[model samples]
Target: MNTQLMPSVSVEDITRAHLRLKGIVLDSPLQYSHRLSEIYGANIYLKREDLQEVRSYKIRGAYNNMSLLSDAQRAQGVVCASAGNHSQGMALACAKMGVRGTIFMPSVTPQQKVKKAKAFGKEFVEVVLVGDTYDDAYAEAIKAAETNGWTFVHPFDDLNTIAGQGTVGLEIYSAANFPIHKVVMAIGGGGLSAGVGSFFKALSPETEIIGVEPKGAPSMYESLRAGKIVNLEKIDSFVDGAAVRQVGKINFPIVQEVVKEVILVPEGQVCATMLDLYNEDGIVAEPAGCLSVAALAKLGDIRGQNIVCVIGGGNNDIARTSEIQERALLWAGLKHYFIVEFPQRAGALRDFLHVLGPDDDITHFEYTKKHNRAVGPALVGIQLSDPATYDDTMKRMAESGFKTRAINKDSTLFEMFI
Candidate 1:
């Protein structure tokens, strides 16, 4: 653990970045969210970075970093690694500036984002699919950049990148009619949080800065608690945009200094939030994009408080919707998976069906019969109308003359099956 102080990006630096980004980047809306306000009983505003041309705030930093490159550097080109959003930003930047570049992305990155990155950059950017996570691709990008002497545009952590992200806070402050009580945003590599937090602390000292991270990939959350940077051994890459094994070295110190609190939101809750945003408000937000709003439940008694939640991006792949809904259902306790021993005799399955309540429906079932076995284990998935009835349902199943084991309740089984 290193306790050394790192260079900070000043408010002046962000203001200058804001100036440089004018005309190049859209001033994304700071729109009032009526649905969220009613639910949380707070005056909630959303900084819709998802509405940007590249559907993310990443363009701010990517463009700022690329724009500052000297003519000689631009001619030599640039390199970067991103899960999705940042690559799209860099791709757009490469095309807009006419700079040839290479973008490395994880193999697990959504195809929607991969296509967009290629489309945005056109002939100027080469998209390379590397390992399974951003960190994996980052290593390869770093090596390639070092070998070729190309300018490496870091996704987060660089002074210029932090400054560019800070402009989001500047815009939020400028557009708000009331004094902001709190500013909530997602922390990926800590660039967004560090930049915005620094600006808010300088201009609106009383306004609290809250950083949200996926519980499965709590790099920033763990690092802050440990009082230094702590690299994670593994992470759930479901929230791919924010899923990194470690926060940027430069970003950690700044975030540690400026952010008032950090919240760890479960990946399941993030999925639910994504569905809510889509179904309720007609908003299409990616998983990481929903992190800030997903964290509102953890913030107690924010009634009437003027809050701002930055919606980071909207590059969601339609194909992932089923998985997102499954996660959401599981998190809400409305879904369950179980291993059940069923009698080989006829009518056993029909008798077992009677154990479920009227509102409970079987979502999945897999069974294989054995030649002379008295019983066989079947995998069953059930969805309930009310989570409160889970215990009652389990009790009924136990008394129904069938052996059963709840997969959802067992961590090992949950990971293996679900």
Candidate 2:
């Protein structure tokens, strides 16, 4: 592997990509996040592709790939599968080009994403909701393509699509005349990385392109190290947008050539990042959308580097904000749930409440006594705004003579007891 022989990551390619996608995609804002920059010792510039028309960097790839289609192929229409972004990208591109399209999404996808996919198509494409995971939908899309004679438009893993995604690098380099030392982004199918990394590699060869993935779903991370696409047996769908079983074929090659480092973020950390974006910046960032910001907590230190973190997408379904917040608490170790063993006496519950710290609030409480009401246990959830407060709260509970068992990270018992 001669690092110098193949110029997959180069400036010329990135510049060409910028020229290619100039009028097609928005420049997307590159703004400084004061709060984040202060927290993580670095010059943090958030590439807000989340504000793009389709609320993601996906449009760049979809449009680039679809635009290269011959007139005859465009008439034949294109088909693709995505949990959200890519579908919307194809929809918008298809509508603009008057090319009919069929998009397949997993059944578990949120209603908001489905709606966005619909709006992006604007009558130029047909949305087909299918399967339970991105892999399932991708498989279904491939199957349907054969019967309908539609060209399967992969979300990543295509040359033109990579070129389209490369546009981001083009915009960033042009907008920031100064050198950017580092770039970080979330990788799903890897098209965004392939394209963006390729461009950055060419333009700013010294700039590092870091890809972040949820620890629960490390398909791309594993694939990159393995030097080929690899499959994960399981992935937590909490970050539903980016949880993928395998990396894209075409996307992997580009990543191998251009990516500098890959980082894995905990799902809970992603949740915390989302909340930070919302509470501090007044921006609602979905779990996958918060990947780059999530990097600040994991990337050891970078005091002086000019860094850019891509806010990949912002299609946050308002309905799930509460759950996101809850997850954030658990991840931050500020919330704990306990199943207390106590005698079912009059002062039992009262005594427990008195032990809670001043800032601790009872978020959830449930109890059940066996056939005998005189003795049993109760399951309680304590939500502390600050994790530091838990120690005092526990010390008080022990002093008050209350015996309890904690189960915060145990998913199995959490579902059954709390």
Over 1-418, each residue of candidate 2 has an lDDT whose tens digit, in order, gives 6655542534554456567677778899899878777877778998999888888888988887887788888888789989888888899899888999999998888789899899978889888888778998999899888988889888876777777788887778778866798888998878777777877766578999999999999998898788777999888877877889998776777788888878999988898888878888987777888898898767777887788998989888888877887888888888899877777778777877898877679988887676675567778888886888888888887788778878876789887864
- State every prediction's TM-score relative to the real structure: 0.98, 0.93
All candidates' lDDT scores? 0.93, 0.82
- Encode model 1's per-residue lDDT on 1-418: one tens digit a residue: 3535567888899999999999878899998999999999999999999999999999999999887899999999899999999999999999988999999999999999999999999999999999999999999999999999999999997989999999999999899879999999999999899999989888898999999999999999999999888999999999998999999999988898799999999998999999999999999999999899999999999998999999999999999999999999999999999999988889998999987999999999999886678889999999999999999999999889799999887989888877
Candidate 1 clash figure, as a count: 0
What residue runs in model 2 are displaced by over 4 Å at the alpha carbon?
1-20, 395-403
List clashing residue pairs in candidate 2: 9-201, 9-202, 10-201, 10-202, 10-203, 11-202, 11-203
What's the number of clashes in each of the models? 0, 7
Among these predictions, the greatest TM-score belongs to 1
